[model samples]
Target: MKKTTETLRGNYFFKQDELIYVNRNDENFVGPFHDHDFLEIAYIVEGEGFHHIGESVQKVRKGELFYLPIGISHVFRPKSTSGQKLVVINCLFSPNLLPKLIAFASEKPTVDFLWRMRDGLLSNYSVRDRNDRFERLFQSMFEQYSTRAPGCEDMLHALLFQLMVELHRSMRESENTDQSLPKEAAFQDLLHYLRNNCEQELTLSHLAHLSGFSERHLQRLFHQHTGQSWFKYWQSVRVRRSSELLLRTSDKIQHIAEAVGYKDIHSFNAVFKRLTGLTPSQYRKRE
Candidate 1:
């Protein structure tokens, strides 16, 4: 079997104490499944391709950048059509190469998310330079590293740090854009629970325990998010489900009331009338 995980010759890419940089231009290159000891940042500068990261294959296009954590097996399969070529810029650096940038990010509110990406919790953490911000940064760094001009090392570090900050900013922006309300998964799950278990005895304590939140906090969130008190919202849900049962089933009023968490017919009738402006019998008769 062909050996997987092509261990890179570190000295060939890096000069002395400098980091590794590569501007790969290939017409039909199929890089082997491999990994590096240091973190790798690969940017597609031209053409499109498929990246085999671990067990998953993701399509990559021009102006896209991917951050690969150390020792994660991956390979590049560049696509070509009508003599077109794929161009990629690879930036490989030691763990300590970005100390200042990492330290600055550690002090930010998105520190947990940054750690998630670094720890490979996101697995395939990638961002497309849709606006060409990262694209230009990579281009400038590649030129400096390839040419080895005077003060090129300093210039490269500056560009690399800028890209690092932009990457963190972009990731946070994307996350914020995707999650507009900042609601926790448990809160959403609670809504799902309420929808399915409207007939069950659900109390503030039970919901707070289920969501791992304080009763007062959960109650505040419930009313703030839905614009209704917990009891009122749950009563509305029970009433809605009861309306459906009334139309679709021949169950009696007392049984229906009990089935929808109402042990007393009078209480159920009063709530139903308050919400729907009609008694269960009247609703059933009309439908």
Candidate 2:
């Protein structure tokens, strides 16, 4: 029989009423592959090790914070060198632990993180602590959990809230810097507009005007951020979307081509074949 999440709770020594608390400091510990019902926020307090999540193993050093959603089989393997210890502060909690009022009142970023995790979008997400504040936040939360003073639960909630806000900001900044331009709100809006308006006639001048930037400036940023010319990037997006429509809908090839901004069937077939190495008909047949 597959182990349920409640089994993990029993191993972690969770009391009946306490669903959220920090794990005790582990020294030179090797964990077994396990899946759990609750979500886990793991902060490496000290030492270095390998984090095995599903089929991938990532080197985890001190100052890395990772959030593992429910039911991901994972384990931490301590480095074999002598005197090396791996300590992690794991905050485990059920989805129902957080009040609905908190989710409703939280900032958009915080709410976004919650919803993404709930919707199974942010699996195996890890962010290094660049500002060194995340470790401190975990330490403070662990201390509060240990103390159990009056209003400790509220304090834990506040600390977790701050951690979530910081994590969301860090993840956004990391995404912006990862092989892409600083995709702040404006850039995201531009992408959204492009995807929605892919069927329409697209031009650099039109995009530049819509973006409220000069054509030269928009072209420069677009190339620098995406490592592609605006026209090429737009074409790539259109072709990718066309592939989705090809397999998902019974739309005719000419209509699909027109919907993806290509009025000419030959032009669409050429571009799609170049990118996907298969004609649309061939790709759909395989699917």
Candidate 3:
């Protein structure tokens, strides 16, 4: 990935509530492990290196794909003195933007593999060749991403569907390799509760009781699945909602704070500044 100091020459892009960055990386660059609120997929257009994902590490080369579950801490960089060239495309999207069927299917590979790929799975499929017609689909996706046009959302959807189909075919060819766990269903239920009740006064005990787990167990589950504590995750949800309100509405800062369950405007301002590096008023004005 390009450093913050690098100047981008192309019309690099971002979507409403989503982001995509395509960049080239030189050798010996290491990014710190971090996690965020969006799912990430990285396609290696070229290069060879080691990718550290959760507890698993693997060598990644050209035409390889890596899936990062939302909020899973990981890092990727060159691993050898020879270094490597990399063309990286990173796409981040909110879970709310996904279709209901797709969202539900994400918890079960029996269904989800047909629609999407889960985290921690790497395939060595040759996406550069059209010998079996599979490369044609990849080429179409590459073209759609490279030359985004009007109604590109439709194009992106089609390309994503094609990519999923190719991955599903690969999974079937490999004898339906089962690598993901079934814990996503329970996690999804917990997340749904959190999203619905974000505006209410919530506590660890309350959330634990609602999710049918003890407080400690709930914390562990959240850390395992999302790579963050429940409190920090909930704070991110509040910050994101507050950011939306700040951008789109004329609501007062205090009111926006209250709407997201912060009773004290001072505390809200402090936390908001800590997370976003801007005062609420400043954020709104900049937006």
Candidate 4:
């Protein structure tokens, strides 16, 4: 038997850089397939279940970790008729938060690892191995969440760094890797343009001009590499920024909308509903 709950109600918890949620499930529960923009790492603290990442399905047990890249679809549920007990640490992190990590790896070496990992490359590491250093790090992270002490953010960052290092190591050990490099130089330029001028009305023509690509060529390249059109991608960035305002500030919806590049609330509302299935006011209520 599987059960479902709208745990966070809405995406209000992660308006800023990211949000962390610790979930304890004491009954048989199954999640419908879903995906999000931020990276997700799930640590199964107890019991056994089947996890579906992309097209591959595998059994996940206590002390095991599941890593999901941005926009990757995944689902997990108990493997038995009886209920199961499990603890899941859900971490949402911005891709921009780890520039140093990405830059350190050669573009060819890293993209292959990232692509394979996205395709369900499970590691031999066990989450229940209490002796494992990474397990200890997770325990410490759980403690920080529990205590909410001063300097918790610093502690969390340290733990996250350690976790990333371990994941990178695991990635290196995987075989049949695809080591082709991405057009990172061009992508970085696009990132800079988006960050600096998010407030201004931006268009594909403007972005293509800034990136030194013809508008049609830029559209083809962006879609082929990033899986989204320029307009759709920029809207995602704006909506993410707007979510932060809605969660952390008392700014009016119209004001928040404008701050994120929308000049009209109606347009903002339509886009918000399309992305999150909730109007700004409805989303605010969930918060």
Clashing pairs in 2: none
Error of 1 at 2 (Å): 9.8
Ranking by lDDT: 2, 1, 4, 3
Q: Tell me which residue pairs clash in candidate 4.
A: 15-244, 63-126, 63-127, 63-128, 64-127
- Tens-place lDDT per residue, model 3, 86-142, is 545554444443453254343465355533433324332322211223434445555
Q: What is the lDDT of residue 73 in candidate 3?
A: 59
Segments in model 2 whose C-alpha atoms lie over 4 Å from true places: 1-7, 10-13, 27-30, 100-106, 177-287
Per-residue CA lDDT of candidate 2, range 129-176, in tens?
Answer: 754668778889988989889998778888877777777777777666
Instruction: Score each candidate by Cα lDDT.
Output: 0.76, 0.78, 0.62, 0.65
Best by TM-score: 2
Candidate 1, residues 1-287, lDDT tens digits: the string is: 44467876556667786765656556255466888767778898888878887877888888889988877888777665556666788878765565534555546645564455455565547986744678788889888988989998778777877787777776766678556333454576677688778668889998888877898988888788889888888998899999999999999999999988889899999999999999899999996
Question: Candidate 3 at 214: error in angstroms?
Answer: 2.3
Residue 249 shift from truth in candidate 2, angstroms? 71
lDDT (Cα) of model 2: 0.78
The window of 10 residues in a row where model 1 has the poorest summed lDDT is 177-186
At residue 215, what lDDT does model 2 achieve?
86
TM-scores for all predictions:
0.54, 0.56, 0.43, 0.45
